[model samples]
Target: MSEGAFKKYGKRTLVYLFLILMSIISVFPLYWCFISSCNNTQQILGGRMVPSTHLIENLKNLFAQQDVLNAFKNSVINTVLVLVLSLAICSIAGYGFEIFHDKGKDAVMAVIMMSMMVPFVAILVPLFQMFTKMGFVNKYIGYILPSLSTPFLIMLFRNNARTFPKEVLEAARVDGLSEFGIFVRMFVPMMRPTFAAAATITFMNTWNAYLWPKVVLQTPDSITMPMLVANLLSGYVVDYGVVMAGVTICTLPTVIVFFILQKSFTEAVAGAVK
Candidate 1:
């Protein structure tokens, strides 16, 4: 082969090799978790890489010993509430900021944007104190409140809203459609990709959330999936198989949701300005 052809093929081969290596690196932990879930503790501790016949036993222990089903229910409740309220609030806020076009609103948005720089951990203590005073602890509200309106989500919608054609709004207004009506009927349908993207992100984050829920949810009845996994990991004797089983269950929903919305997610995120 010519030197130029050799160089071109070499570069392509190198790129493919790098990607394959990264894919293995990324997928290894998940593979390990699944394998561990299907193995006895001894097999796991001995670094077993292959699947075993212990998955049913591990799952049986998980369901019998832990509140696996209850945790699933709690996680679903919190995730659904957060996803619905967050999307509604952030989308509307984003629509208003972009469509309204005023200096005062812009100033308010600047302040809100400034909040993105403040880590949630920095305000976690204050939030806990405030929620405690409000008697929100151990309640689904406590789990759902903090995430109902995030700045990043609002910004995402706002940037995408800017790309929405203003002519549609003008025509709707000329036809005497109310602003709320227009938003509900026109804006939402047109932004399915963005909404799908937002839903995927919100669902995953809320589903996998550990720390905030851990701080608020105290009762056994209110425990989430992550908390359930943590519980499996705890106690005087830890069962690796059971813990891995719990982890697999906890991780499954987010994985499913991502795969379902992945195409829209990639499109919307790519189209997001900045």
Candidate 2:
């Protein structure tokens, strides 16, 4: 090869190496968790890496100690509801902010973006009080409702909405379609990639929510998988094997969701870059 071509190849090689290193660093903890979960308590304590025959035993122990199945069910329900409702609300809000020619729309969008800067803890007390008054304490609504007005998700949708084709809206209007009908039929189908990315993100966040769920869901039955994982460690004594098993189980659904949506997610990202 020419010297310049060799130099270009070397740069590409370095980039690939750097990406591989980063990938290993990111995935190592999850790999360790899975391997550790397969081992017995003694094996885990001894830092065993190779798979052991005790995985079934550890799984049994996990189920015996934590009602993880019930928590998993609750997580699935809460995540699905939040994902559907948030996408609908945020996407519509985004469409309005994008299509409608309102003078104050940009200011409203800025205010919404600024709301995301406030720390969740700062509003915890007021949020708790509001939830109490609204009668959402210890209910699924408590878990689902708090996530509906996600400014970040709305911002994501709005940014994606800017890339939407305007001619379709004009054509739909000429066809005598209502504004809502135009959005529902034309805009939504075209924005599938954006929706997929948003769904993956929102589902993961809802599924993994711990602190707010723990605070509002006072009842044992209302608890989620993350809460169940936290409950695994009692004061001093911690069961390493069962905890690892529980974590692995908790992580599975998010991984599945990502894989399912990965194509659209990648397209959305690439489109944004373009």
* Candidate RMSDs in order: 1.7, 2.8
Q: What lDDT tens digits, residue by residue, belong to model 2 across residues 1-274? A: 6999999999999999999999999988888888888988789889887888878988999998878889999988998899899999998998888788377998898888888889988988999999999999989999888899787777777778887778877889999999999989998999887888878777778888888998899988989988988888874778798888998898878777778887765554454334
Off by over 4 Å in 2: 1-21, 263-274
Candidate 2 least-lDDT 10 residues: 265-274
Error of 2 at 123 (Å): 0.6
Q: Which residue pairs clash in candidate 2?
A: none
Q: List candidate 1 segments past 4 Å from native.
A: 1-8, 267-273
Query: How accurate locally is residue 104 in candidate 1, as Cα lDDT from 0 to 100?
Result: 97
Q: For candidate 1, lDDT tens digit of each residue in 1-274?
A: 6999999999999999999999999999998997789998899999999999999999999899988899899999999999899999999999999999699999999999999899889989999999999999999999999999988789889988997898999999999999999899999999988898888878878898989999999999999999989888667888899999999999877777677888866665664547
Give TM-scores for every candidate, taking all chains together and pairing residue i with residue i.
0.94, 0.89
| Most accurate candidate by lDDT | 1
